[model samples]
Target: MNRSHELQLLSLEMQNELFRILDFWSKKAIDSEFGGFVGRINAAGEVVPKASKGAVLNTRLLWTFSATYRKTSNELYRTMADRAYDYLLDYFWDKEDGGLFWECDYQGKPINTRKQAYGQGFGVYAFSEYFLATGNKESLAYARELFALLEEKYRDPEFEGYIEALSADWQLMEDMRLSPKDANSPKSMNTHLHILEPYTNLYRAWPNEKLKERILVLIKLFQKRIIDPKTGHFNLFFDRNWTVQSEIVSYGHDIEGAWLLHEAALETDETEVIQSVRQSALKLVEVTSNEGTDTDGSVWYEKEGDQIDKDRHWWVQAEAMVGLMDAWEITNDDWYFQGLQKAWEYIRANLLDTQNGEWFWSVDDQGNPNAKEDKVGFWKCPYHNSRALIELISRINKLKI
Candidate 1:
């Protein structure tokens, strides 16, 4: 055996980045006024006191810190996770509706009470991880409640999919876009992909039969609808009847879903499902690498047909490292390992803020960092990069070095 010298060196970088990412969030994101976490931090490293908080950011904070604590048993991580949990329940939870509000004012009052299925999925994901770390019954109950609520309210019977969002009380909403850039469609690969991620995490703590079934269904759904067979990329937006509504190819989601789908299948007892997922997962990796990544090793943001978005976004690079590493583990291919090395190098050279603690949101075509984007905000939570580092570190430790 070569003793995994290559992986050992890479693991050192990942461990360092993991701590930096967590430390930055802990020190800067805590809100003294609002109870949960701060709503946003501008690009200049200044916190926006009056910025509204989001369920997505808070729940992702809960998940990231809880996951870090579970693996390391660090008291500081536990305290941070506790803070996220306390704030999440205190402000974000809709007691009457049994789901989380989409957004809240700086004073912790609900401003947008719509129940986005995506938000509820993170609720299950975060609460389940917290329960795993602490064995807290209340957290477990919340996780299960969110899981059930998602099934009851979001699951589409006719399409065997999920609707995007509903009113606070679960009534159908006319506008179903997850974000302004997103198409107003009932079903989306992004939503379904994220829902599958949380459900997979929740199954780790509960492992109920229904949860397993849903996980299996979600995996098959990816194969049948979410992933376009010809391109091996995700179909971004979709309608109620499982029709793909947009032609956008989200490289981050494609690569992330590659490994995630495989992870979901592994949690189940179905042999056929695991085998099917294996092939689909590998195809996703291959296609994304071929079309979605640059020669310098960073993944692109998105592409449609032959038109590509050349800018490198923070989350895209974070996911690319993990996705390539996961592909290496699946096939034991040095090619994927090489890709991972390139991604890490690119991130270090471009996205990482050497003077600051966290990473830059993105670098443009000329390799200049995008300064207008929020350093920490509703969409810029610590989940992607932190999770990527954690995943890489954990996987490296498992190798027979």
Candidate 2:
């Protein structure tokens, strides 16, 4: 097929996959007895009704449905987004505290009331998208409120980047870990990356001068602190003074950041920053494509020194496809295009669960699905894969193939 034909085919495929994802989540993940969506659904397709609901899952659901509604004008998607938005404000929003609580019970009561910066970022992201979808002034107001809250509560004046976690009342917490698997450090690449992502989205919706200034600060944080100049890989964890705390390389974050950084720069509309980040984005993509990808085009989970995690996670592969296609757009490189194709092939063969709906959590090195992980959970949501499909469809259509 010609290059134009190839892109057209890819766009159609991505659109189909995007709708399939929306259909799966809308039908399977909704909560009937309890408001909003269920917290956990096992690999056996059973909902764990009593599972503690996470801010991330709910916020992502809000963003996905809102964005889908915006794209398709589907009233069902709008209804779902409205349900998520109401649940978020009614249950997750700490009205007195001003930021979202980390987790809530199935009955929509706060369980873990810690204010995670990552969760706050997603809150802004979802709310802004909801506003764009429905032109709801309240949603936009809440989004702007969250943005201000993050700036006031999470931003460390002594340090450049935001803190990881705080108490429900916005007090500093000793254990600032996002999860048990993460390092208990004051700073993390994950939190800062998410913050940058939402800020960019918020800027698209609001375009305030202060938001623009903060977005530039986040871009600089990536340039100076998070990304290693010597190696393109990101330093996973950090101390308060911007000290690198861990030698771990999270492949998912790297590829995700590769494009996110570029998008942030693009949002700024500054020629100099855009030109600089364009180069940095390609380098990050190059490193990930070289060291992180398996032979079958699946991205490895992470690497600490020589100890490489061979698990091919669903999110990692999802991000890899977008990031690689992003690189292809920047450089018009056929290699990156091939990488994108390979990633799609691997995802269709391995990551996607044919019998069950939606993508699996991950597959082992040998391409065996990890059945132990929850299919829908706090960390596992429709955001990455769904966004990837939407992103690929949009990006491919823009390519002058």
Candidate 3:
């Protein structure tokens, strides 16, 4: 097939997959009994009632549906977005404190009340998308409020980058890690990348000098602190003074942040920043394609020293497709386009659950889906793969070919 035909065919598949994803969430993921979406659906496609709801999952649900609604004006998507928005306000919002509570019980009672910067960033991301889709002044106000909360509580003035986690009342915490797997560092590339993502969306909804300035600061930080120039990988964890804490390389974040940082700069229209970031973004994509992507075009989970965890994560595949297409867009390189094609084929053949509605959490090196993980849970939300489809379809439509 010619390049234009190739693009057309893939775009059709992506559109189908995107709606399949949304339909799965709409039909199977909703929680009629407990108010918001169900907190946990196991690998067997069974919902676990009474599971604690997470702010990240809820907020991502809000973003996925709102963004789709914005594009298609689908009332079903609008209903899903409204449900997520109402649930967040009724359950997740920290009415007394400034930011969102991390988790809530199945019945909508706050459980893990500590405020996480990552979750807060998703709040900003989701609320901003909600506002942009519906023009709801209250959603925009909430997004702005979350932005101010992140600035006031998380942003470190002396050391620069934002902190990882704070107490329920927004005080410093001893165990500040987002999860047990993460190092207990005061700062993280993941947190900063997420914050940059939402801030970019918020700037689209409502451009303010302070928000744009923060976005610029974050773009620079990634270019300097997060990205290793020698290797084109992100330094995962960092201390309060911006010292690197870990050498672990996550291929997912490397590719995800590559396009995200570029997107941030594009939103700002700062020529110097965008020009600088373009080079880094292409380099990051090239490096990830070289070092981290498998021969089968599946992106690995992480690399520590000489040991590479060979598990093909679902999120990594999603981001790799976008990053590869992004590089192709910039350079018109057939290498990246081929990489995108191979990676999407890999996902279709390996990661997708033919029996279930949504994609599997991961497939091992031997190409077997790990059946132990949750299908939909705190970590497994609709954002990554859905966003990839959304981005790819939009970009493909704009292609001259």
lDDT values, one for every candidate: 0.90, 0.91, 0.93
Residue 26 deviation, candidate 3, in Å?
0.4
After the best TM-score superposition of candidate 1, give how far the Cα of residue 194 lies from its true spot, in angstroms: 0.9
| Rank ordering of all candidates by lDDT, starting from the highest | 3, 2, 1
Off by over 4 Å in 1: 1-3
Best by lDDT: 3
TM-score per candidate = 0.98, 0.98, 0.99
Candidate 1: clashing residue pairs, number: 0
Query: C-alpha displacement of 113 in model 1, angstroms?
Result: 0.5
Could you list the CA RMSD of all candidates, in the order they appear?
1.2, 0.9, 0.8
For model 3, residues 157-211, the per-residue Cα lDDT tens digits are 9989899999999888999889989999999999999999999999999999999
What does candidate 1's lDDT look like per residue over 206-226, in tens digits?
A: 989999989988888889988
With candidate 1 superimposed using the best TM-score fit, by how many Å does residue 381's alpha carbon deviate from the native?
Answer: 0.5
